[model samples]
Target: MYQDEIIQRVNNAAEIENSNEMLIIRKIEESEKPMELMLNENDRISDIKIRKLVDCIVGRKIIAEKVLLIRDHFVSLHDYLDLLNSGCLFDDEYDALFATFGNFEISCIL
Candidate 1:
C-alpha cells in the first residue's frame, strides 16, 4: 500500500508538470495570435488581437519592447517567446512563476 501511494504521487506530479507545459504552449500561441494575423495580412492586424496583446504585456515593462518593437508607427513581433514566458500571461499569483517576459502600449492601431 505504501509503495502504491508513492507511485500514485509521482504519477500525479508528472501529470501536473505535463499539464503546465501544455498550458504554457497554449498561452504562447494565444498571445502571439495577434501578431501572426498581422504577418499574413500585409501588416494589417485585428483590433481584437491587439487588445489581446495589450492584455499580455501590461506591467511587463522590461520585456515589452523586446518582445514587440514599434517604430515609424509599425509594430512587429520581436522575441515572441518572451511574450509567452511573461508572468503577465497568467492572472493568478500562484501560477505567475509557473511561466516566464514586456511593456507595450496601443498607439497606432493598424
Candidate 2:
C-alpha cells in the first residue's frame, strides 16, 4: 500500500482510539510557530522529509508512534528508503542517491 493509504489507516485508527482527535489537532496547530522554529534548528537537511514529517505529525497524518519508529530506525538504509517512499522526502531516484552517499555515517555529522 502507498504511504497515503497507510497514513489514512493510522488516522482512522487514532480516531477510533480517541473520538476527540480533532481537538488534539487543534491544540497542536496552536503551537505551530515555535514548532517551526525548532524544526528549522533541529533539521540538518534541506530535505522535505524532515518538514513533511513535521507536518504529518502535527496534522496527525500519521501517528506519533509510527513517526518515532521511523526516526529511531533511520540508521538503516532500507528504513531510510521507507521513510523517503512515504512522501517524507523528494528522492526521485533512490538508487543513485544511495550510491553517492551510502558510505556517509549519520554519527559523523561533523
Candidate 3:
C-alpha cells in the first residue's frame, strides 16, 4: 500500500548524506511498523477503517508534516500512532508538526 511506498522511500532517504534526507528517513523508520499495525483491518474499530479514515482526515500535507516530525524526533512510531488513534492529534510535539502543515480542521471533533 502507500505506507509500503513510504517505507521504501524512507529506506532510500536514509542512505543519503544530507541532513534533511536523513531526517525524513528517521521519521519513516519510526513510523513504519506502528503505522502498519494501526492499519491492520482486524484491529480497526467497527465503524472506522483506520488507514482509510486517516488518509481522508489527514490528507497529503498533514501526512507529510507528520513524517517530517517523526524523522526529527527519536520516539517510536507506535507512540504517535497511538496518540492519533486515541484522538490526541494536537498533543505535545504533535501540535508543532500539525502547525507546520498549516492550520487544519481535524475531522473528528473533540
What TM-score against the true fold does each predicted structure earn?
Answer: 0.22, 0.21, 0.19
Steric overlap count per candidate: 8, 1, 2
Give the Å shift of residue 103 in candidate 2: 7.7
- Candidate 1 residue 57 Cα shift, in angstroms, is 1.4
Please list the Cα RMSD from the true structure of every candidate, rounded to 1 decimal place.
Answer: 15.3, 18.6, 16.6
Worst 10 residues of 2 by lDDT: 31-40
Q: Across residues 1-110, which tens digit of lDDT does each residue of candidate 2 receive? A: 36576678778888678655442322334423321111122334435654565355345433444445444435434445445555643333333333323223332321
| lDDT at residue 68 of model 3 (Cα atoms) | 62
* lDDT score, candidate 2: 0.43
Q: Could you give candidate 1's per-residue lDDT for residues 1-110 as a string of tens digits? A: 36666667767877777654421112244543242222122454455665566464564554434234322222334322234344444445313322222112222121
lDDT of 3 by residue, 4-102 (tens): 788877777667645553333334453233322112233323234444444543553554555564434313334335545755244444655444332
Q: For residue 80, give model 1's deviation from the true position in Å.
A: 17
Q: Give the worst 10-residue stretch by lDDT in candidate 3.
A: 101-110
